[model samples]
Target: MIKFLVLCLIFLFLPFQAATRKQILIGEINHELKNLSALKIVVFKPTISEETEYASMVIQAFRNYFVKKLAFDLKDRENISIEVILITDKEGKGQIIEQKEDQGQGTVFFGKSKQEIKSSFFNKEGIQIYPTRSSSLKENLELPSLLEAQSDSVLFLLDFDNTIVLRDDQYRGQGEHLKPLEYKIKELLGISYPKILPEETSINIGDKAPNILLEGRKLSDYQGMILVLTFYPAAYSGIFDTSLITKRISEHHLSMMSCAMHITSFDGLSSKIGGLGVGYFAVSESTPEILANWKEVLETYHIQYINNPDYSLSKSFGSYNSNGYNKRVCVIIDKKGYDILPISIMINDYKLGKKKEIQEIVEKLMINI
Candidate 1:
């Protein structure tokens, strides 16, 4: 009876003991491999879960985000790779398993429980483990430690919304949720850029204007001609009514010099002003959808449309917004290719239908030029 009771106790405690043993093995492996130069990202794939597809989507989204963010510069960093594991509740539930027999080399593990895996990847020296609730995962994820672990080439165990099991694509979330993590990774990799530039140092008047590619032609190709560059939000946002502005500006014969003048419009078909010296050109980001939508209007106006798809032109001119639109500002470039305006002149507001302000500004600038 005593032996039978002891055996029963061992059976009850066997799972716990195995779990503890796996935890120790993971710690030892992490300690042994923390200083290696190869960095691997381990994602656990659940063998039995109704949300398996959702988890796969999340993984793909993460992979896509990482590739889109880092692929351009990843060629220089050959030490990074992603590995997926088919993890089950029994054998590898919360343990670090090696990919090969070569110890201290290759992929690591992403434990099922947060407490089971104490990350040595982000710590300067030795592993630091913290107990955390799944809801407060982001707060307790030790982002600062991640930033500090810049020198260590180690694997990352990413948990999406506190669980490896996601319900659906919508529940998987978007890249915005992972943006903070992405930014930290980029910073650690030394490839992060500032979100916003200082106004004083950004593009300003009197500075040599940055060159722009309009369609196949470079802005430099239009040198010696006074360029009236209009940056607008979209084809027809009502903030800057292209039709009215074009008509107003064309009425003044701003392009009478045959110097290749450009005007952007939303509703009107491209048409040449009769015997007018003004050359009407419209510039926009070149995309198939935009081109298709604006085809009829562009044809009606007879306007030369230039493609600025990346918005590099608008951004260089300080007219771009982070929300993927250009500000309603008109930039006047002199014949010498310098931004001649001391201040951005406000055009018509569609709400008020005012047109005189832009007319006056353009007329005045033309006279001075």
Candidate 2:
């Protein structure tokens, strides 16, 4: 059976032959990665095959962009080791193929599986050698690219606990002044603050909320079905403070009523007082330490917002444009923890309407899913 032996040898050696003039990305192989302290990496020159130069450029760009992030993630997990075998121009010519996606452009190339390594490199698409965890890795891995940082506008991010403190505490110089400061609610109305928070940010409506504490009380424990997270200057007996407090509270009640016209206020603002009632989780005043903490978190998340004690998040996200915080606005976070949906942001109305109709659109997006 000399013929049989020849066929067997060909099959065994075929992979090496097929691998020539192409890139090889060895990922998720069961072999010990920890043993690999460091390994050499290779890159294959790209050429225009049956595909467009633009499409090839994008793919090549992404591959280079993501490698660093991928390596870091893998190292952090401490489970796998990856080594780039080589990158070379394609040796043989093949039929061209192109894949497109819904919003933006997406591309796929057809050739030897070994030529290109992708997130979906090894399913039914590639040889499944050892049962691997590539799919799981794909989910957790975020490829680093300049795509996210390129957005032109400045993004002001804030965290719940640290950036703004809702409780009363003695502060050092200049810290007290920072509190009770009013935000230019008017500036927010007409100005574009991204006008949208992406689902990727993970803050939403109705999501199982973490128990937020205020004044030594867990707001999460409130039995009331509706929770309102309102911000405002603390209640003080001064004539100016008293009038502002009363007027703000009255506006909150009125807005709740309007929301009821479309839906019942019961399941609507479920009587929960913690995340609900006036001044629940609202951070009215804060200590320097507390403010810094919130600032750090905001910077980490890239949330865009200007700090103003006079303007609650409600007023800023709601009607009050550039001028200051006034009128109470509510963000109905869904059970899944995303902004429920943005409603109309109207400047024409005196009470200040939703300027971007973000609430309605966000609602539709949540509902359809």
Whose TM-score is greatest here? 1
- Residue 191 displacement in candidate 1 (angstroms): 21
Off by over 4 Å in 2: 1-202, 232-282, 286-329, 332-369
In order, candidate lDDTs are 0.35, 0.27
Q: Which stretches of candidate 1 lie over 4 Å from their true place?
A: 1-207, 236-281, 286-289, 297-302, 336-354, 361-369
lDDT of 1: 0.35
lDDT digits (tens) for residues 81-176 of candidate 2? 223222212322423333322111122223223233222211121111131234443233221121221111111111111121111121111111
- Candidate 2: C-alpha RMSD after superposition: 25.0
Q: Once model 2 is optimally superposed onto the true structure by TM-score, how far is the C-alpha of residue 232 displaced, in angstroms? A: 4.1
Taking all chains together, each candidate's TM-score versus the true structure is 0.33, 0.19
Per-residue CA lDDT of candidate 1, range 1-369, in tens? 999999999999999775433211122223443333322233223311222223322332343334322221445445443222222212222343212211121111122222222121111111122222132322332212222111111124323211121111112212222333443444445653335333222465556666656556665666445455555543311111234445645577442211011233322212312112223344444333333323332233454444555667667767665644444444545543343323333332121122244444445555554
